[model samples]
Target: MLLNHNQSSLSFHSELYSFVPEDHILRRVHDLVDFSFINDLVKESYCVYYGRPANEPELLFRLLFLQFLYNLSDERVIEDSQYNLAYKWFLGLNPEDSLPDSSQLSRFRVHRLGANRVEKVLEHIVKQCVEKGLIQSKALIIDSTHTLANAAKGKPLDVLKKAANRLLKGVKKQYSSLYKKLPMFPKLEGADEEKAKQLLQYLVELRNLLEDKLPDAEGSLLEKINTVKQIIEDERLLTNKGIASAVDPDARFGRKSNSRTFYGFKNHIAMTEEEIITAIHVTPGNEDDGKQLQTLVNKTREQQITIDEVFADTAYSRKENLTFLQTDEIKASIPLNPAVYGTREDDKFQYDKENDEVICPAGHTSIRKAKTGRTGTGTNPCLTFYFDTNICKQCPFKDGCYNNTKEKTYSISIKSEEHIHQMAYLDSDEYLQRKGLRSNIEHKNAELKNAHRMTRAKYRGQFGMRIQAFLTAFVVNVKRMIKLEMAHSE
Candidate 1:
């Protein structure tokens, strides 16, 4: 069973070979990258000389890859491998080969190819594309997308109390002695629910009592109780933990600008200038997008891809990110946040950095210039300009721009010189070209959500979400490399 002995060879009577066209994407994917790398990546996860053999690791992983490649669920992919000739050809199955049950794919993913190997397998496939000249990697386009969590946003107070009590009863078999002495949690129902405040306080107390009594308890039990305790502490309405899924408590409430909000995870991606995704990372929903640029940059270097420029939207325009990219000698094409620049209109004043002074709107220059070194925490200080308000009071624009100041000479601070210099290219033709390329990542995000089934996670928990992202990106790269190859041929 482990050896996959049902493979078919060239035959005069068979039409399987002619069924698929030469221009098919799967054929291109198969011929482009070697699947042999999977066997090496997952060999240690399997039993070498075992009792009743198991599904071959390579075939199983290929089936999972097929699911991601075409956006099929586990059942659909297995069904396709059984009846679809193109799928059969891709899986190297004989005409009468039996499809494994759908349950097998789930078990293999959770048990066989855990998070580590899943990541490494993706990297190995990327290396193949690099050798074939499909990915240039000279520039990286960065962005993030949200995936909704499987759990509900809020559970009623009574509902949560019952759920928690049920979990405690289920665990009683392991700690019979400890369970008997534990305090019975108060069960509050009905209109007293608005006393949800009291309910939270009670849960926190119960959690502390349980931990104090069972000091040496398994970490998992402690974690469940702790999750409930933290939920009580974080939310006034007492929605599960800060996470939406109690079972998958790692997912968080992610904020996307001021308009959209969802409970789930965020996928941060770094794509090559050619549009192939080179790296991806998953973070809690509420995490800041600005924090992951350095991490994505690090992943590219680990794969030996040199990143000469990184372009991102305003969400990733924090000072630290700009400084890091600058220190690394990679061009940081981040736009300035509106908060960084005050009420200065376009061409309101021209700044001469070499002379260390600014000309006001009325055509008079500032009286003095001041600057400070980097803070102990390492962020660049804003450059402050001192304006003589006595002169400003006589100017036409003073009523609109300078009324907020107290000094006869008003002082204004703007973001660092480096940030201003980097943002100066906002109007260049070259900048617009590159920015257009950055927006193309939105199409890729759509493809993942629409074509690859990333809209809602198929499995629960953070690691499961990561597996889904990695495999989806791998399949996408395979398809893209083929398209690029075909276009070149044409």
Candidate 2:
């Protein structure tokens, strides 16, 4: 049950908090933010009239806030708060009052706030910033950073074996009698591929057995069953781009650059010029950065924050995105990707925007074009323009440009009038200045990883990653708001 929100009476020990200076960061944060809303946000998740008196949701939330603010683990945060006077004062606990057990932090995080409500934590914080007039700029910057998965990448066979063993163990542990009725682990005496098929078949049988016997299994057993189902249904299990770990099935392989890759999740973020984060979109590592632009924009707009301009890298320069900004009448300072505009050696080919065709160096225009390749894959989808080889065969430029190829084609990965207009805007002084503003978000990303320990996930699975990301964003935003407030006062 959620306890009452009555203020605790001051005790003799409470006076000891006087030693914590009024100018302390936590003190400033406590004054800046009215954390009482936390209680309301988590009220429904708690039992109102049943169970023993539970810790106040606000208090538990404060502990979590302190935990992320200091970059401490669950145990360490509770332990440190017990002795740290400033922490005690920030938590609004009497000096002698004992803290709730560290484990409560996880229970509260997983059950109370959870994935559904965690996002509200960030949204509420951003709302507070807007209310205070801390976020004044109409321009928002968008970017994404990677968080390494807690689980290591494993081979397909190893992943299958591990998942099966986990399911079997969970069944035995939870329902011993049911375990005995289930089929034993399948014997393997063949090549890796053959053994994998046998193990997969056994897992399917095992799932059917459990579903029949324990039709209402919940918690870890249900989770394990679901995990096994995922492993079974994944057709790309044997491929490199497939599930790499049963422990973190949500994570996928994503590239940091052409030479560097990371296996984990991405924290796609949108921030104001004030450096306060307005929205966060978490996805598997392999998710496209460009796809999240609309999500981030809509999320920011949800807060009633007017977004007249967006600053981002070339990844956000897709033709669709340019059109999106244009329709909304929002200014976009994103750099154009050469792939979208189609580059050439010494400008041998030029796009004729009016006719929607490419002009060869010899002034030969393309006849027809076809869009090829699947979008949202790692590869860039292109519009391939087929030129008549009949004209190329008799042209002087045929030797180097056309040769004797069956099809004389010029391909541009992306094309639109929006892109053409964007290309022209890219050279303007306004675009150049705003382009540099996007780099400021890079520092914020670094601070999140280096200072808050968001470089690697602290918990397993996508849910855990979302919890980590939003909470960290909350801490960072709170700190930034405090700084902004301080500056305003001076």
The TM-score values for the models, in the order shown, are 0.79, 0.90
On the 0 to 100 scale, the lDDT of residue 450 in model 1 is: 92
- State in Å the error of residue 100, model 2: 0.9
In order, candidate lDDTs are: 0.74, 0.89
Query: What's model 2's lDDT at 107?
Result: 93
**Per-residue lDDT for 1-490 in model 2, tens only?**
8888654568888878889998899999989998888888999988889998889888899999999988888999999999999998888888888999988899999998999899999999999998999998999999999999999998888888999889989988988887888887878979988887888788889888888888899999899998888888888887757888988888899999999999999999999999999999999999989999999999999999999999998888776788889899998999877676568667579888899999998998999999998865444578899898999999987767877889988888765567778878887888876678989999999999999998999998899999999999999999999999999999
Q: How many clashing pairs per prediction, in order?
A: 2, 0
Report the poorest 10 consecutive residues by lDDT, candidate 1.
Answer: 236-245
lDDT string for model 1 (345-431, tens) is 654776676887777767788887677445754345555677777777777777656775665343344557666767776657677
Q: What would you estimate as the lDDT of candidate 1? A: 0.74
Supply candidate 2's per-residue lDDT for 110.
98
